[model samples]
Target: MGRVTTEPSAYHRRMAEQKRSAIIDAATGLFLDSGYDGTSLARIAEAAGVSRATLFKQFPTKAALFDAIVTEYWKVEGEGGLDLRPGDLRAGLTAVGRRYVALLTRPRMVALFRIVIAEAPRFPELGQTQFKRGKMPYFTSVRRYLEAEHEAGTVRLDDPELATTQFLGMIADYVFWPRMLLVDWSPDEASMARAVDEAVLTIEARYATSSARPA
Candidate 1:
């Protein structure tokens, strides 16, 4: 029985998570196709094949759902912590840079950003929500990672925030931000990998201490 059986609560929780994913997927598509204001929670529930009661139970307001979208878009929940441990500046940054590149280049991520930019004048809350709920937490992890490296003497920085901005800015300026302005801009995987390498090298050049330099 233990081997083949599922606890009712575990099953229920799995089912609940699935429903949430469905709701988010449905809501994202609707938000993309119809715009946030043009879409409604009830419509999202219908598109998701869940009841209005269920959708409201998970997200009471459209803003709440949109916030959820931003959170999910960044995979921000379990990703609150950095993968680095305060050594190997080039290696740590290269890993982080690659992950950042992947996130920035995701199709859904671009759409999520587009929605915020497209609707910013009308629904300023969406932009604020994305910045606070989506951007800050992710950046905080990177900042903390940089701070840890600074403390360990792996990297020397007068201002970590500035360095963090500079490092991530390099990657985004190449691989990510162009998509926002140039409608057809899409760099291939090799280009993205090159961007990551270049950012890592730039940071290593400016920030990594002599001892921290790899052999």
Candidate 2:
């Protein structure tokens, strides 16, 4: 009978985490260089200086690895604590709008969106997972601010989810679907800035109540 290895110690666990982070970074570089479909597990393992077996031990499948990369790449701390006070609805929405614009304009973020959209048909749940962990958190963060405004009688949103979706849709429209679909022209800084400004103005116009209007 084969002898089973004992569980890793706390120190070993930390070291393992470091290795996994390194592997993910290496995989990200490869994914960006060769695209997800072009990149292979062996290539990632070689790049990470790990054996194929070790890579599998860390991430069972390509989809699993991609999902981890997606979540980690977009992950932001303190997003759950977005300030939702009752004053300056336009300013508050603009802050959130700019953050979204920044995210969409990032090179890595654009690449990630392309990868996910291309692979989404094969992996239906991929979109759902990304939406749940990535987009949902962002929406929830902004929704908290919206809810506060509603409670304070500054905004009049009966359905916070609908409001959140509408606000995000405005930002999405600025990305230009043809460019996303064809990997054509990237948004310049000036264009992105204008888009963010317009999105904030639109959302505020739709949702702001008397008290929340900018003074």
Candidate 3:
């Protein structure tokens, strides 16, 4: 049998993806350990086992790499895996709340927020980019869900967008802020469950239509 030859283009593409993933993995760890300003491209290149030229070829700037990290971590499904049970508003909200909490309280996410806040003053665009790309999509998804529930008469909200923001704020207040600010703060499963339960209750009390209530 004749020897088979691999296509040069295919091999290069596969190698490129591997190198990109390695850089992202290394950068994520270093960025979390050392804040944005503290970490450098050279350090990331070393950690990723690639040369400086390779790192720059993949990500031309630090901001580009940081944005990539945010996109990777913050990209969640539009519905956030909410189960839209027709009359079970509480259950749906609880599911969404739990997922939201998981996303917000992840260690890498918390670290990224800290980095953005710390470096935003110097690079204002970073904050804007994070808000537009990382945060807005989740907000929009929640708003769309609330709007759908409102149209279905399952919830009664004058402004679905505002209600969505408030619901997210409630969850963030209980889960995200503490984790972000306190170096050693870690909530047990029971505490997290309680928080999500409380959040769901709060949202339902505020917005659920009388008809949506379980008989």
Candidate 4:
């Protein structure tokens, strides 16, 4: 068959994505200001400037909207996935680490986390939803990257999950976890860069196979 014409569908898809983003942004702000329990879909639709019918069509329930907010917030840019070469352990992880830092440092991301922390007690499912739907995908990507590196003979990791924990935890403890407690816990670019570099070196030291080791 000849090349298919996709112009109309692509235009429609772009419009749908734009509307979805608006809905998510409106709902996220409302959830932060009003708490998940206090915010309603009608208000979110009005704030987003979309029709209530449209909002309902996109997100039929408040929980679903919250889930979308959580999932969409954590999604990495680009293809929203790790696109690392299989064997270049250091370079790949440096990219991943920088991406993680970028994710953590976004203002809306911090606010989103704060919203989850503040509202989670009364609305425990929000916490579960954030962890399950938002956080785990990113976590799993790192773990799977480690696993792939091992398979590619780039690293020798028996416990990819633990390795993932160690790698991400090191950087998060320095750059992210502190911000959760200290409102003014922003690290300088040099310091965050050092954190990522050091984490990569540590993982490489522990896990790089003999042939993968530096000459």
lDDT of each: 0.87, 0.76, 0.81, 0.89
Tell me the spans in candidate 3 whose CA falls farther than 4 Å from its real position: 1-18, 32-38, 77-87
Total clashing pairs in model 2:
0
**How many clashes does each candidate structure show, in the order listed?**
0, 0, 0, 0
Q: Cα deviation in Å at residue 3, candidate 1?
A: 20
lDDT of 3 by residue, 40-68 (tens): 99999999999999999879898899888
* Candidate 1 lDDT over residue span 34-109, tens digit each: 9999999999999999999999999999998999888887763235346678777887888888878877876678
The RMSD of every model to the true structure, in order and in angstroms, is 3.2, 5.4, 3.7, 3.1
Q: What's the C-alpha lDDT at position 79 in model 2?
A: 47
lDDT at residue 13 of model 1 (Cα atoms): 94
Candidate that beats the other on lDDT, 1 or 4, i.e. the better one: 4
For candidate 1, the 10 contiguous residues with the lowest summed lDDT are: 74-83
- Model 1 alpha-carbon miss at residue 146, Å: 1.0
Give the candidate number with the greatest TM-score: 1
lDDT at 160, model 2: 92
* Top candidate, metric lDDT: 4
Candidate numbers sorted by TM-score from highest down: 1, 4, 3, 2
Give one digit per residue, the lDDT tens place, for model 2 in 1-215: 99797989899999888878877888877876776778898899999988899899989887788778777766654544466566677777877777776656654666666666766787667677677766777778788888887887778988998888888788778764545766666778788778778877877788887666667
